[model samples]
Target: MDINLVLSELQKQNKSVYKNVFNQFYKGMVLYANNFLFDQQTSEDIVQEVFIWLWENAKNIEINTSLKSYLYAMVRNRCLNYLKSIKITDDLNLIDLNSALLLEEDIDNISEDEKAIIYRQILKIVEGFPASMQQIFKLKFVENYKYNEIADELGISVNTVKTQLKRAKLKIGESIPLLLALFLHH
Candidate 1:
């Protein structure tokens, strides 16, 4: 598919083109979001929000990269914001619990610096992956490319892309807790 042509049609508010792009990306976006959020419903909601935002701002939207990349980045940022909001809510609940007990202790919330450290650590871990795996991971998460897109770009099979991504996720997941603990303990 000619992504450029599709994007131009989208900018023109062509309903058929919009529907085609939505159909092409919706499932992939949801899956990409679910990697961060781990909740199917929240992932779906975030992807839907992205699509709605695209439709509403189609005329003014300026995408420098492929539309797939832009959409994936949007969903990724939203998921990160959602996670931060959840953390803040949890901290508030803890504060309320302490207040109910009449205790005057301080509660430490996750700071932005800590979040940055965690993100940097994760990126480092990804960098340590094999070249093929690293490329696949970046395409899937960083650029938000679908399996087919990654496969086509790399001249590999879709199954190869999926396998490499799965392996990368497992490796990253294993290291994340240790990285978080190391940073949070400081």
Candidate 2:
């Protein structure tokens, strides 16, 4: 169960060796991940995922230095990414809260229930949009696609794609100002 033996076994793609490796490093990896991510469960999940990825990509993975250092580095980066995502979600939630606060004075005009209903309606509308439009919107908004990339994939002129995107945003702006505001405000 030595480190060198584990690495050699892993390089040879031996599945049995992973049990021992996981047992030996699981606690240390979780602790390392928790240093950045703060949540114990998330840290453990990230560590597990990193180990799984290591196993899957073991053939191409060149361990020049100690396996421990490599594993620790992977755990650290994954933890940092998890922390960053949490920060982003927190910021978006804060914007939603601020929007609620701003609309609070007109409570009778726009109740929280009404806001939820409107959001659901907007989601339905997006679902009903043309497949091409839906894909473009998802790539641009959800997957963060660049104009050039989207154009290349869609096999359309850049300006035409940009125009379509602009029209889509304008339509959304008019149909669902709250949702558009939230996206832009973020």
Candidate 3:
């Protein structure tokens, strides 16, 4: 499916095409939102809200960029706005804002090979997490396993799996800027 067609279809009020786009992009967009908020439910809610708004105003909305870029930018802005609404002065949230900026653009300046190396370094950071935490993190994000699936395989509760994943996101999130700096210095 060509994502480029999404804009034209939505403009034409093509419900089927809209559903297809949602199915194709929803999971990835949710993950992208999670990278900012680190709260699964809220991330899902934010993405849902974005999609709802998209459909409700599809005919009126103007998107000059690719649908992927527009969708991600919307999610990123919402996530950052949520963080600000809570309290922007907090130091941890400041770190999150930095991470959001880096992620929202997906580091477009870097080549695919550079991104792979950065991903490897990020994995090294994940390696520093506790054994089970690292395992659960990899299973969820790398393998795209659901919480229940991860819980079942690890013989742990879903809540436990969620907690570990959250911690993993936070830890890895904190290192994003530093890693970007490292990559830039090279």
Give lDDT per model, in order.
0.73, 0.65, 0.74
Worst 10 residues of 1 by lDDT: 94-103
Please estimate how well model 1 matches the true structure, expressed as its whole-model Cα lDDT.
0.73
Q: Candidate 1 or 2, higher TM-score?
A: 1
TM-score of 1: 0.47
67 Cα displacement, candidate 3 (Å): 0.4
lDDT of 1 by residue, 19-107 (tens): 98899889999999977765677899999999999998987888788889999999999999997875522222322221322222222
TM-score per candidate, chains pooled: 0.47, 0.45, 0.49
- Model 3 residue 63 CA deviation in Å: 1.5
| Residues 1-186, model 3: lDDT tens digits | 455477779888899998988998899999998776556777999999999989988877777777888899999999999978755322322222235424544455665666666665565676678889977876776556889999999999999998887787788768776767665556
Residue 4, model 3: Cα distance from true site in angstroms:
6.4
